[model samples]
Target chain A: MPAIDLSTTPLRELNQSLHALAEGNNETEWEVLNPDGRHAVAVGIDAPVSVDIRGPVGYYCGGMNKQATVTVHGSAGPGVAENMMSGKVVIKGDVSQYAGATGRGGMLVVEGNAASRCGISMKGIDIVVKGSIGHMSAFMAQTGNLVVLGDAGDALGDSIYEARLFVRGNVQSLGADCVEKEMRDEHLELLEDLLQRSGITGVKPSEFRRYGSARKLYNFNIDNADAY
Target chain B: MCGIVGLFLKNEALEPQLGALTSAMLATMCERGPDSAGFAVYGQSLDGEAKITLQSSSPEIDFPALAKALENEIAGAVKLTQRATHAVLTCRRDELDTIRAAVRRLAPSVRVMGVGEAIEIYKEVGYPTAVSERFELKGMKGTHAIGHTRMATESAVTTLGAHPFSTGPDQCLVHNGSLSNHNNLRRSLAHDGIQLETQNDSEVAAAYLTWRMKQGLDLGQALEKSLDDLDGFFTFVVGTKNGFGVLRDPIACKPAVLAETDDYVAFGSEYRALVGLPGIDTAKVWEPEPATVYFWER
Candidate 1:
């Protein structure tokens, strides 16, 4: 394991140094110490390497990530793992707004709370939040699975296109065209697997509920006009 | 700080380009602030008025009184209506200075940043694009402009407290970082009879530059004085009728990236915002020096 000290170095220099150290066919697990809320730190990593960021990030951390398992020891700013294609991003602390936003693929696990608009416009990401999420979470979500262990705020999943919402706690309200779905055996099994993958094993899978779009607003329907 | 972007073509050729450019800049700096967004478009003449559009805090002061005072004291014919905090007014181009002066007098507690004849300011409590869309910013037009997206750390979060703050006639400023000597400088400027509008630390810097410019100092000299007098980590860009100026604190705590070519010049809180612009001279990209003043003439 290699260590990159970013105390006094600029973020671009730190990224260059880390990338330089990771280059040359060196697939080493690197530890970034004293991150100190830098923006775009450890972004666009493609190598099959693992990185552990020490503290909270400023913005766009781990953006467009591919094939890199990045873990943050602290909270994240907006657009964490944004547009991610592959790999895993694990946040040990609460995350700021727009976590996994517009991500196409990969898994994002938030151990603590997440701010508003989490997974907004997400294409194909899997987000598992152990705590609550703010209002307008998953707005305009095209395709994704958002698992929230705690309560959600107002207008959850408003204007969603196609996304699966699984919540263990109370939901404040459903967004436009979103309705509660029956949690059956298949969903329970899938939730169990996701929770276990996120390292949350204590809760029973049957405790959670499922919510998704009723397809009422997929096309313009004069009969269901009032639902909109 | 705030983001300012406006385009004033002699014949309305580059409205789309300017709006796209401003939107790109704001989107790139979205993380710089996710608070409020507002903007103005200058060419729309409704009822033979200049059709100045503005966004601000809701349930504001009376526009009639503001317009009447501006008409009497500032020498402008002002007609203003409030939709929430945003006020769209129309006045003669010559009366812009008087309107600005009267606004300062009327809204002493309001941060009057971003004052220009064709000025556009977009600020809210979120990313710049979202705020811009909420305010329907795509149709704004002029020859040139300025905008701001604010991150609330030192000041309270309100539409009245957003950026692209106006200092004087045809002058607007967008600030990125803090000004440590705001209180002391505010008192000194107040002693010089410059009434302040907001509690924001950056407002003092904007007002200081405006007062200096009002005293016949050029933008470069006023910015230089601010670099010398104002304390703390600040990187700001000021726009005027002539052009725009960029300044940074000696400590260099804030960050600004500049990209300029023969056709256009752009600046952002980050470089990615300007990455995919038209006619981008990627090689000429550079960050301005700390405590240095850089301005572009119209």
Candidate 2:
């Protein structure tokens, strides 16, 4: 394990060192101290490594990550794990807007609440939020799964596409082309598996409701002009 | 992008440190907004006296002569204290409108930054640290303050385009994002008799709040109405005579974090701006929700 103190080490150097590590190297465990809410920490890493950040971080933490496990002990700013390719990024505390936005793959978990636009435009990632998610989460998402245990803010899944959404708590409103769908045995089994993989418990998979695109605007028929 | 920091003190004992603490917070956000900076400080107000902050491109020639001219016109004692590019003119409370009119006539270049019993605004087109130092913000004493550092997106980079745009008596606003409908809204607000100062969209937001408050809405109500009337991405921190309010647009693309302790309530564009506050590690930190109004008043 290697320890880098961000209070003294420049963010560029720390990220460089993280990127230098080879895949499956023995020194795969790293620790970041005194993050101090700096932006772009541990970004663009493509190794199978673990990074434990001791404090809060600013925007774009673990952005574009692949096969790297990054965990922030404190809260995170906006765009955490944005466009992540693979691996996992975990926030022990709350997160700001657009957490896990446009992520293509891998898992992003927020132990606390996520602000507006959480998982916006997510493309194939698996996002699990233990707490509430803010307005417009999963908006225009092309593909992925977003699971929330707590309540959701206004206009959840607005104009969504191809993404699977499950929420156990109340949704303030639903967006265009998004509607509640029947939770069949397959969806229940998938939700149960996702919950188990994300280490979520106490909430039954049967308690969740599924939402996705209604597909009415997939090709834009003339009848949909009034809704537009 | 722009950075905004606000401090509202619940304990009078911390009044002396408000400017220093707010300056530190503003400095941390210099990277987010490097074009221009400004701040509004709320100090102790005196009965029957008003403080009018004014800015002039030619401070040396205009500041001295304007104070004497204002004194003669209002028939009262006028005190003018000059910072680098700004000056605070203290006069009888009732004489503010007359003094303002006189300034418009006497020195047309002198811009009225703010007029109130307690609020004094200082702004410039420079780095936040330099602007704060030029105004001696670190040594000032106040109960609450709001500051902004801007990266120009909506308008040209000028001293007049800075944040902390004050539109009414003791009312000021700092915005982070550009409004899509400000041009139309500005015309409507101007039609309603709210004097607008700049083409900047944020000035329209300040004037809109002023117009709403003039119509007998409280600060919270004005902010609530803003969600419906104002369009575009915005995270606004507003300062009043005794209240501080924060509002985010419905989309909430911009970032805003809030931290509150028993002694103070603080707002920052990001969590990094708040890392230097006293008891911040123990403070209750949260992100302001979209289309919601949060205000604290004495």
Candidate 3:
């Protein structure tokens, strides 16, 4: 295990050293100390390593990650795990806006609340938030599963496409072309697996409400001109 | 992007450190908005007296004769405390309007930053640390203060365009996001006899609140009205003589974090600004809900 003190080592050098490591190397475990709310830490890693950041990080931590596991002990700034392809990113504390934005694959878990646009344009990633999320959490989401154990803010899934949303608590409002749909057994089974994968317990899948696109705005229609 | 920070002290012991704490918070936000910065402090107030904060490009020439000329014009005693490029003019409450008019007539180049019994504003076109140092903000004492770092999206990077815009007496507003309908609202507000100072969209927001307050609406009511009437993405932190308010638009595209403890209520564009405050780790931290008004008054 390698321990890097961010107070003495620049973030760029640490990231560069992490990026230079070969896959499946013995030096796979790393620790980042004294993050101090700096942006873009542990970004663009393509290795199967594990990095634990001791303190709060600024924007875009673990962005575009592949096969790496990054965890933050403190809160995260905006865009945590943004555009991640394949890996696991975890925030022990709260996260700011656009968490897991545009992620294609991998799992992002937030122990605390996630701010606005938590999974905006998410393309096949899975995000599970133990706390509430802010407005427009999954705007224009093409595919993925966004599970919120707590309440959601306004416009939960506006302009969404194909993505699935599960909220155990109240939703402030639904977004354009996004609406609550009936949760059948298959959806419940899917949510159950997601809840298990995210290590969420004590709540059954039956308690969650599913939201997705209405499909009315999927194609151009003359009657939909007024809504547009 | 722009950054906004506010500190409202509930404990009297922390009053002396208001400016220092707020300066630290503002410094953390320099990356969000590096163009310019401004701040307004609410200090001790005197009965029957008003404090007018003024800024001059040529402080050596305009500020020296300002206090004496304004005292003569208003027929009252005036005291001037000059910083690098700003000054606070204290005069009789009844003579505030007359003194402001006299200063405008005496020196058109001088801009009035704010006017109130307890508020003094200092701002300039520089980095947050530089502006705070120029005004000696760390040494000031106050009950509450609000600061802004501007990114200059809608307007030029002039001193006048700097934030903490004060259009009404003792009332100033700092906003993070741009308003879409500000030009139309500015015209309507101007038609309603509200005098606007700059083309900056944020000044219109301040004037709008002032106009609402003048119409017998309290701060909370004015903020509620703003949710319905004001169109745009905004997270506004407003300062009054005795009140500090935070409001965000319905969409809440802009970010705002709030933390409150037994000693103080603090607001920042991000949590990092609040991390350095005393007892922040134990404070009740949360994100402000959209279309909601949170205010604290002494």
Worst 10 residues of 3 chain A by lDDT: A216-225
- lDDT winner: 2
The recovered share of true contacts, given per candidate in order, is 0.00, 0.76, 0.12
Candidate 2: stretches off by over 4 Å = A220-228, B72-76
Clashing pairs in 3: none
As a whole number from 0 to 100, the lDDT of residue B126 in candidate 1 is 60
Runs off by more than 4 Å, candidate 3: A179-185, A220-228, B59-62
Give the per-residue lDDT digits (tens) of candidate 2, residues B1-298. Answer: 9999999999999999999999999999899899999999999999999999988887466688779988889888999898988999999888888998999999888888999999999999999999999999999899999999999999999999998999999999999999999999988877877767778999999999999999999999999999899989899999999999999987778889999999999999989899988999999999887788999999
For residue B266, model 1's alpha carbon misses the true position, in angstroms, by 0.1
Judged by DockQ cut-offs, the docking class of candidate 3 is: acceptable
lDDT of 3 by residue, B175-291 (tens): 999999999999999899998878899999999999999999888889889998899889999988889899999778788889999999999888778878999878888788788
The residue ranges of model 1 lying beyond 4 angstroms of the native Cα positions read: A1-228, B1-13, B38-84, B93-116, B120-122, B281-283
Q: lDDT (CA) for every model shown? A: 0.72, 0.92, 0.92
Model 3 chain B is weakest, by summed lDDT over 10 consecutive residues, at B57-66
Q: What number of clashing residue pairs does each candidate have, in the order they appear?
A: 46, 0, 0
Per-residue lDDT of A59-153 in model 3, one digit per residue for the tens?
Answer: 89999999999999988988999999999999999999999999999999999999889999999999999999988889999999999999998
Tens digit per residue, CA lDDT, model 2, A1-228: 889999899999999998888756798889999998999999999999999999999999999999999999999999999999999999999999899999999999999999889999999999999999988889898898999999888888888889999999999999888999999999999998888888888889999999999987567798768976
